[model samples]
Target: MENAAWYVLPNEADIETPSLIFYVDRIKENIRLLINMIDDKSRLRPHVKTHKCIEVTQLLLHAGIKKFKCATIAEAEMLGLSGADDVLLAYQPVGANILRFIKLIKQFPNTNFSCLVDDFKVAAQLAEQASAEDCIIQIYIDLNVGMNRTGVLVNEATALFKQLSKLKNLSMIGLHAYDGHIHDSEMRVRKEKSKPIIEILKNLSKELEEIGGRKLNIVAGGTPTFPIYAKETDFDCSPGTFVLWDKGYQDAYSEQPFLPAALVISRVISQPAKELICLDLGYKAVASEKPLLNRVFFLNAPELHVESQSEEHLVLSDTKSHSYKIGTVLYGLPYHICPTVALYEKAVILDADGNIQYWDIIARKRKITI
Candidate 1:
């Protein structure tokens, strides 16, 4: 995914169907545009769950990005191996995961690792393990701005922070306020809904700084509210999908400068009916979270209507009466590119010189070498 001085594409004949094609130029452009938007690389702590490749992480590092946010320990491990200096495991670790997380930190001593905690009981467990390992683990208090997911409520954050401060071997570094609820397509509506939550953080940061006696880093927002969060200098923005813009986000947020860097290239395999053709792009290749229409945007055959989709086949009805011969190549922009990328083991990365190479999905698997 990293752009080298010499880049190009591979022979079309060598590529198999249902393969992910990653554009090197577009990836680099996205990185540059994000940095330019932030006006400083230090303000951005991009999530790595989108593209799990080490090359992509290295690309971000090359762009002067040091901090990274990930959802899993596997992703954190990949980041550590990629020489990422600082990484935040955004999800709260529970059960045996607490010990696994501590082990990860020990393995990558050079990488400053942190995880989220909404409950003091989980924080207590983490503190115990960190104490056992004789290591101090950094933690971010997960604050629920609007999303009723994993974070502690805004009103309860300060109390939990105070409780976490008392836990042994656990450092309350900052607050993780993820407002995934404010995903209005319109920027004005998105901003309006996110304003109160932003204020909550502003107030919370002031309270924490005064009481904690230090500047507390607030990592907030996702792809939709990235622009709004970017304006706040004190908050560190963690937007994942901005790296490889997908049809879903690109259509919703047209103002974002990111290009469709990731795509699923399928081929017409069978002419089942007069105007109906079967494609190799199935639910296995694409993310089925969205509806059929929003699942993928057919680049070549925009007029094609999706008839049905199964594990390995996607039937489409071409209304234009245009006939595509069997084996004809077609490209599709997945609506949800994150899970779509996860479906594939490796990507057929195309360079500027028309040469194709493969990049392994290093963090795609569930477990690391723990």
Candidate 2:
């Protein structure tokens, strides 16, 4: 089907502008491809940072994806609410969040909740809290693995893993590394860049397992290295963006065939100039971290180029085009779907039957009754 046929909502009149719309058929297809990409369905612990809605989580769980990864407490709680089998709180919690993490575990007895640990003090804090509550929280060593964003270096991580194991109420499941920094348009380049880190993590897990006397579960990489890590049996692939893939990954990673499953509907509210049009979609509506040209790709109006954006209005201008008029609807695919999804309270889900329903972006909040 053409982009218009798939992206244009049949109940467009019912929905408001600057809304997040999910094409359920495409999302289901993406999940199918994601599972088929990996050898073991258990190894596919997809991240929930993209589509935090419980409905999407249910779709994944129904598709046989038992394990999941997320960055926030709300995401983990959201997973727990869905009766998720294994939920990894992929971020290292500190300060008050440590207690909140414990509360999540206590609240959701059925869901196995785990977290990442880079600092021993934080692990001890969590262990103390868990011990006090008489509950256990599973943890993965958050390794740096060249991201430099968070996590300890390999040398430190190896020692940290050994130290974290001795603590009570903290289950040392495996090593967790996010190679989100490795999205090189070319798969070969991505593979090449990811090799040393993958090897290091694998060797570390192998050595750690010998000491611990069990299989060390390593959750590694994101959408960019999903295919690369799919080749590794030990590493659990925790790609988040594949559910509602964006223009960035679609344009960068050609090897992965996951279709774009979500879109932002924006209407031309005003045409201030012959070549300038204003949209209801602004930074508040869609993700705005990328440059004006790369923020959102107008699937219908490829000619439209972003000129400026504020909280409530997005201005577009095309030097040679003057055909766009007020009330002209445009479908946009965000450059980064993860953060974009967080901008909305709920999504307008367009089901396979062309019916529209509202699904709360449940985990979008920082806290969810935890």
Q: Rate the local accuracy (lDDT) of all candidates.
A: 0.88, 0.88
TM of each candidate vs. truth: 0.96, 0.96
lDDT of 1: 0.88
lDDT of 2: 0.88
Q: How far off is residue 239 in model 1, in Å?
A: 0.9
Give the per-residue Cα lDDT of candidate 2 at 335.
90
Which residue pairs come into collision in candidate 2?
A: none
Q: For residue 274, what is the lDDT in candidate 1?
A: 88
TM-score of predicted model 1?
0.96
* Tens digit per residue, CA lDDT, model 1, 105-185: 999999999999999898999988898899999999998887898899888988988888788899888989888888889
Please write out the lDDT profile of model 2 over residues 19-131, one tens digit for every residue: 99888888999999988888888899999999999999999999999999988999998899998999888899999999998888888888888889899998999999999
